[model samples]
Target: MTASRFLDVIVGVVRQHLPAGVSTRDLDGFMDRNRGLMESHIQRQLGGLLARLPGPGSASAEDPELPELWTAAKRTAANLAAMVVAAKLGAERRNPTAQERATLRGYSGWGGLSIEGAASKFPEGFPVPEARGLIHEYYTPSKVAAEIARAVRDLLPTLTGEEGVIHALEPSAGIGRMLSAFSGLGFEDLIWHAAEWSELSGRMLRALYPKLDLYQGPFERWIRERGPNWTGRLHLIVSNPPYGARGAAVAEDPDREYREKRAYAYFLRRALDLLAPSGLGVFLIPSGFLTARTGEMLTLREKVLRRHHLAAAFRLPSVKPGGREALFPGAMLVTDLLFFRARGGELPEVDTADRGILEGSYYREFPRHILGRELGQDAGDDDQTKKPRWGYQVEGEFSRLPRLVERPICAECRITPLLKELDPKLARNLRMGVMRTSLDLDGDALAPISPAPPRSGSAWTATWRSCRPARPRSPPSSGASCTRRCAPG
Candidate 1:
């Protein structure tokens, strides 16, 4: 049977078991009686369908959509089973109140389906089995993983040279989310290495790409064992390393004293050590790496910034999952794809300069703005001043500040987060603030001036006051200065 036909049959069976005018209370009884048969039947049907499909090598190029559909079906079936179980248990124990049940139902509406379904699909091998029973959890969403992979593709051409095979490594492969991106980038001949700690995930990875070299072990241990061989071997390293900071035991040895450390930092240091000259690395580290205060990070900055140039930083849109509230509460935290070229070689320094202005289409909210402007007829007058400014040059010390502006109002529109919260509709218009002036001065030195008087003879109103001189602040003596001013018109 085709996969589609199997799905239809499963859905049909579920519909038959669903009681008419079924109250939420009846779902548990219905599910308890049918869960086992449904799971067994679906699994058998799916297994048969999969058997008919081509095995990895013999399979004609499988449609990308096929895997997605398979994953979705698996998730849905698993979730339905979990919901039934939870409902049955809730009624049997008489532990949850009606209000609690209602709240659970609401939560189920968004989170329950995915959570239960994910558990069902990978019942034995979740990324972190120790924390499976915890109420809060973390996992990279498929879409976000795909976006990171897309960024890797964007960074590839810059990393590959005219010589040998491209060597890429993903430290925390996590079911090959970023590695899967390689398929889209047309990188079939490259040498790809991934280290995943979870045996289940490793098995999944092997099944997904049977030909690739995958290691099932703690990344740190794998590094210690393979570090020498990888030194100067990797041309590209990308990862969305785990964000846990608690002093937990390393995956390889439970007896070792595993001090508290950011996984990304360890991965960064390892990747740097492994990178070939003129190589590039793209990391999805926590935003805290950019703004946090710690001795380790300071040392890391000194080591990395002094050696490798930072190419670009792209902040992703905040999503509700991944303990985003507790870990990243800065409204939006900036996650970057740091690009670097190894030090001391004939290779030209990596171009860390922002190309948005030269391109004439760079905007922080470029995706939303471009879509709005392109699709809407009432985009109104083009506000050239609000164009995005290149903040920092790749050659300079890595710091949080703007460097160049192609348009006037760019600063106000791009930097101010409040505008979006206050009047989102106005935010869409792209014309609320005064157009900013193009000043050659650094961001910190520029003073904010009120709009010029409508006429020279007009009284100095609050709206047309003199420019406010920026206060002198203590600079990070070791790091680049963080001072930035609103551009003067």
Candidate 2:
């Protein structure tokens, strides 16, 4: 069941049926585009084509990258849809109304080794979990997990009783590192649901987050089969989905832009479909999703912008070379923490420079060194005044609610971007007054009503920018001025 072995067999079998001179590469693209659909048909009609192919052979038991699980993976396709369809019918959605946000204080739990601490139960020689087609399994760091949880907390509705019980889903829960962030946040009535393909990872996750509604299978299957049941109904989705895997299928966003085989892109496109209209999604994906120049990636970006408002974005440094860094323990895959809200973000001008901050050009490049320097002048190191500490540490650079441009989040809610703490504990769930935001919208666009908006959890420094009208009738006095109203996105 090795990928190369199976690939050769599948390709050889398909070649016999190839029409005319269409090369395998061309057919490869065609198959890749329709892989999801093909897999669906195979799941239902497994006997015809699959039965002809050879079954898996005995392989080394000690293989780190074991192919033994590949046989089980193929068998999963047959019952994947049945498994999701037979699961608890339609997913219940949770939405709350009108909450205020007093203070958005940041949390400091990075030192806890949240990712490592949760996986402390795994034995030293535990085999890598690849049964779920997971080629990349980097755990989310605690600092990153807390930041994602903080963003999710902002968009949550303050529902009580049955409605208050938040129905949440994490597409991939490796040992519950990200799931634990949901705890201690005021949302005590959270119903956790997660899908992990590896039995080993599932066992570890179950031990860590007892409340999780665990789905032990590939995310593509669970999301594709169960997504419709929860279509536009889930309150929140937080995940650090797998990266760089192929042959994923999803019923949602069947278009090629959404179907590109990049595992992160495929997972995000489908998972996003299940988000409640006012729900929030916070994911950690490769920066390529944000910066890739490919046409498919570009289309995916546009699709996201058209539907959801890009709220907050942070580009995390990749793992330092030589693997001594304590952050991400996998490949040097530069990642970004992206927060998307149902609505109410300033639209960015495509192809334009800094005007549209979310535009690819704005984030065309990022610092790649390990992030060790604390943000802002508050970092009390004696050499803080020194310039170009490049070799010393990499500064964290991010922006939150950085939507101040030609079009504001309506005129009333438009306030100066202030540097504030991120810990929600310091503040009440404050809601800004309801106001109609004016963004280029189609028929279904709702006036963006946002909560205590999510802020850039990792900002190198905060500068005051005015959100006043383009042409001010009267300039404010020097001492007290409304000029420094908002911060740059």
Give the number of the best model, judged by TM-score: 2
Residue-level error in angstroms, candidate 1, position 228:
0.9
Tens-place lDDT per residue, model 1, 290-319, is 433345544445445433544544434332
Instruction: Give the least accurate 10-residue stretch of model 1, judged by summed lDDT.
Output: 392-401
Where is model 2 more than 4 Å wrong at Cα? 1-135, 154-162, 248-257, 319-326, 344-359, 363-489
- Cα lDDT of model 2 by residue, 24-131, tens digit: 568767756775665566556564554444322111111322221223333233223222221212222222111200000111111212232223433344332343
TM-score of each: 0.44, 0.47
Report the lDDT of model 1 for residue 154. Answer: 31
Whole-model lDDT, candidate 2? 0.44
Model 1 regions lying over 4 Å from their true place:
1-128, 132-139, 161-163, 246-260, 293-296, 320-334, 344-489
TM-score of 2: 0.47
Clash counts per candidate, in order, are 14, 21
lDDT, candidates in the order shown = 0.41, 0.44
TM-score of 1: 0.44
lDDT: which candidate is best? 2
Superposition error at 2 for model 2 (Å) = 48
